[model samples]
Target: MTTDAVFDSPAVPGVPLPAFVQTLLWAGWPMEFLERAQERYGDVFHIHTLLFGKEVVLAHPEDVKEVFTGDPDQLRAGEANQPLEPLVGPRSVLLLDGPEHLRQRRLLLPPFHGERMLKYAAVMRETTAEDLARWPRGAVFSLHPHMQRVTLDIILRTIFGAEDPRDLTDLRAALSKVLDRLGSAFSTIATIPPLRFHLGGFSPWAIFQREMAAADKLVYARIAKRRAEGPREDVLSLLLSATDEEGKPLTDPELRDELMTLLVAGHETTATMLCWAFDLILSHPAVRDRLVEEVTGAEDPQRLPYLDAVLKEVLRMRPVIPAVGRRLSAPLTLRGRHYPTGTLLVPSSYLVHHNPEVYPDPKVFRPERFLDRKSDPYTFFPFGGGVRRCLGMAFAQFEMKVVLAEVFGRVKLKKARPGPAKVTVRVFTFAPEKGVEVVLEG
Candidate 1:
């Protein structure tokens, strides 16, 4: 409990498997591993894995607070996220550290803020409405892909400023292909370093590079056009006009990396969260009735408190990104255990959310808990915390609320199958298995 007491404690208990075996298990069922480890080792443990060498898992709120609130100098998040470099690019904010990270974050923060976010809300509602209008009523269908399409449309329109019909179509097609390939191949490349090697065009890494190049071509073209034409309402235009403290403009490659980061992170996680929300709401009919009533009665659904609670509960029960990783840049003490500089400290969001000390009856799907009490950031963070907290947290949360309100208010829906939906791994996100099958009701 106290850092002094844990300072001399042994390194967190864990399985001592070879890196390859650990990688195999982690890729398949990381949540299961974390759950079992917590049950066996209490709140703190370790997983000696190749993904990031010796990774320690922390679940206690106190430990989480230390990790989130720790000095940026002592904990290097960018180095911890090195595996993501290939996908997000070297200049991505996700892969930057220290002063450079702060710079990129400041430059990117404006477009996702107040007035600009209001404009994006309009896009979110319109895009969701357009997508939902095409769904076959009174028929069972997988909801994940539907949610993905809507979120992708919103991102394309707001982030890339893809207004031309041809440009939108071409970029969407190219990005979709790239995403599909990445979804399948990223886990392998991320877990196994050797597999990331490029062996000509037929190799998976080579194929991924080709797909990214195709997507990049469209992105760079848009960047050039936006530069030539001047500023617009989209994020790309805003970034094009932005200048640092020294008045230095972002370069082409810098713009590409930032745009790619936004494109991928902006849509995918929101889509997964939406799918899980649908699955959770439909699984509990009473909750669904109350949510629908709240959404329908409110002139502005985003103002409905119960609806907000439901969203919070969904995120708590099943965070899209279950853990946030950090590597120690200096010797540090957590839960009384001293960790070396290279130690990989992963704060497990899934375990912390489920901790009974934090939430009584944690397994139960109860939104009222949120209504009754607020949770501290360290205990309930789904978007992570500290300087490395997700930059689009506000944007993602607003989009989910708007989209859910639009969908639930307009249509009656039910789960296609009985019992709780199975959870599965999709890329790095925990998704509702079977794509959260649901039937529309008249």
Candidate 2:
């Protein structure tokens, strides 16, 4: 089908809301809006919103397949991620398109793959053990912040390779402040085009800029120090020494942007997913019992089938990123309907995971479903699909498995309530609303 075919095909139906109202709905409750849109308009529909101009959402497995397997030149994931520019910076791989994005991806892929990632497994285990040891037993606490701290430490030591305790401490504080600010309601408003204006240092945008500057200083210092100290095993050293096809090493700014992208993307999503996994496992006693038995007895905890299945089920049920978007650079046909260029196509992971036809009893948590059958990329892509899929998928999975194994084997945790934990959007990721309250048992 061609662009001409779009005229014959009816416009994709969606909620008819004014731009501002649509933005309000999106900013307030994105998942709810998507769910409602899916129920009312079917799998393929259009939504006109300020964020992406004109957008199309594809929820069914078939439509999502076309999207994932579409021509890379025609579907630009980087352009679709423009809203993240202010946070990850313009030079980040998440924002760059075409050849530059490919170059950066190639360079950044090695450390997160194969034996290199195996080296980080020890770091993940050690950090989780240390952090969990500090938790007060028999006291009610939110596991979210604890998971965040552990994951942050893992990223710092394994990826950034901050050797100095002082540097690590400083960087942690700055990053925490920046992330907290980003998660605020005012920061969400600051992302809007008209509100992006700076009103001196007091404005939310200005404050964010200041925090970014502080973070940049520490990151640059670390980069410079790593450069002078020669090669090391961490991801930073790998990136510094890496070259493009022309054998050109990454520049300081390029390194900084890539590092920041990894720092944010690497830890935040994993931490949030970890919180969800902990809550899910604790809430389901049978699953918890099975997991503990599997983890404790296994020689290689990472190889435990049930633990892996449990993690997969958690991701399927509660994908940290609800949808992965792509803006069409060329007219395309999706779900037998032609769409014009400049249309934003989003593959809703949330909708796809909960599709009753594909997953029977979708609301119920069942890890055994994974063992029964393997999921195709188009059907079960929590890290996304196609060429732009998340580079840290392996590393994140490994970290999750290792951390869960270590924690479950050592500490006994109990849920504070019998009900499921509430979900909330914390910045870009879905997080537990009350932070997954639990008590460490004696």
Candidate 3:
């Protein structure tokens, strides 16, 4: 699959900025890129970013159907998202194609299933409780950082059966640094291709490499220790027990890559969702009051009505993952447009989530829409769509609801300031730039 399409064409015709300038208009995309492009053009269009140096097609639901579910073989997850492909390594399900993706998904699916996910509810409840217990009453603090810590703990307990909170905390901090640096780094560094030796790309990537080495030493060491300790019911044990169609156990590198994929995918994005949810409810007094009402009468925060709706709406508004990219595996066309194979397409969560056609008054944050009816599942994808949908979606939703439940139920917090005042993306994920600061009154 290949394309002769040159990125020189503007983001859309008659737009003031070149595709390049429009891409660079804001750091790491102010909103989803396609969204800004739609404002400049209309539904169907293109957006450019320096790093990938490619133009991605942005589509509305009518256009997106083809790209997302249209031809699974024809439309593929592309190299535009390749930066992390290396870190996640070759066998990561996220970086695979067709049959390979299916196999990895099949192998990875059982442990993340219904009965299994139910076990995390208690972990979520207890972890959230532990974190909420330390919230200093009347003191303003950034919630996302705390949320990150909480999510990591949940992941450790659920995925690894980890109990030493301090060790997990250290691992989370180190991994957090690596992820935060990669998503949005300074201009020059983010765009460069990697070499065996050369210390620039994605903000002191050498330092990141050092951190990776340090984290790897720790993670792999744990893997060995756990191995000696004998079989357990955690994700690692599950992976060890998994057999491919060929009946082979996952290679060591495969195991590490899988762990990294789950760690990075599950950690930052869910934490961002919580951060955005905290800001969303705190800023909108009505939403907050309603949530308090729904959960107040309930004996447990996790069981409250409208709770999941609230999280979905939060994800819809400020989705943790702002964009997703896929390459053309086979030639395809959509929205009356044609493209050759390997044409890079980027989907904008910002635009799709804000599409007034799909979401009425897209700007307003409302949870009622979800309760009203079933809408197109593909359109409002925070966990992404298709087979590659996050392996941790259930875990993410559970963590968010459980943490929010515990906090809202026990810790009463109010936004310390006014306005969204700058709700934005950090690197690739959406988070408050000023950090969603709030004061806990309970």
**What does candidate 1's lDDT look like per residue over 74-191, in tens digits?**
8888898777666678999988888998899889998988556887878888889888989988788999889889888888998999878798889889988877654675544633
Please give, for residues 251-348, the per-residue lDDT of candidate 3 as tens digits: 77777777878887787788878888888888888888888777764665556658878888888888767667778776666655666676787666
Ranking the candidates on TM-score from highest down gives: 2, 1, 3
Least well predicted 10-residue stretch by lDDT in candidate 1:
1-10
- Candidate 3's C-alpha runs over 4 A off are 1-20, 32-34, 165-170, 183-191, 194-196, 199-203, 297-303
Runs in model 2 deviating more than 4 A are: 1-10, 19-30, 48-54
- Please write out the lDDT profile of model 2 over residues 73-107, one tens digit for every residue: 78989998887777788889998778888998898
Cα-lDDT of candidate 1: 0.83
In model 1, which residue pairs have backbone atoms overlapping below 3 Å?
6-336, 6-337, 7-336
The collision pairs in model 3 are 2-341, 78-327, 189-202
Candidate 1 residue-wise lDDT at 12? 66
Which TM-score value belongs to model 3?
Answer: 0.90
- Alpha carbon lDDT of each predicted model: 0.83, 0.84, 0.71
Error of 2 at 159 (Å): 0.6
Off by over 4 Å in 1: 1-9, 17-21, 50-52, 190-192
Task: Indicate whether candidate 1 or candidate 3 has the larger lDDT.
Answer: 1
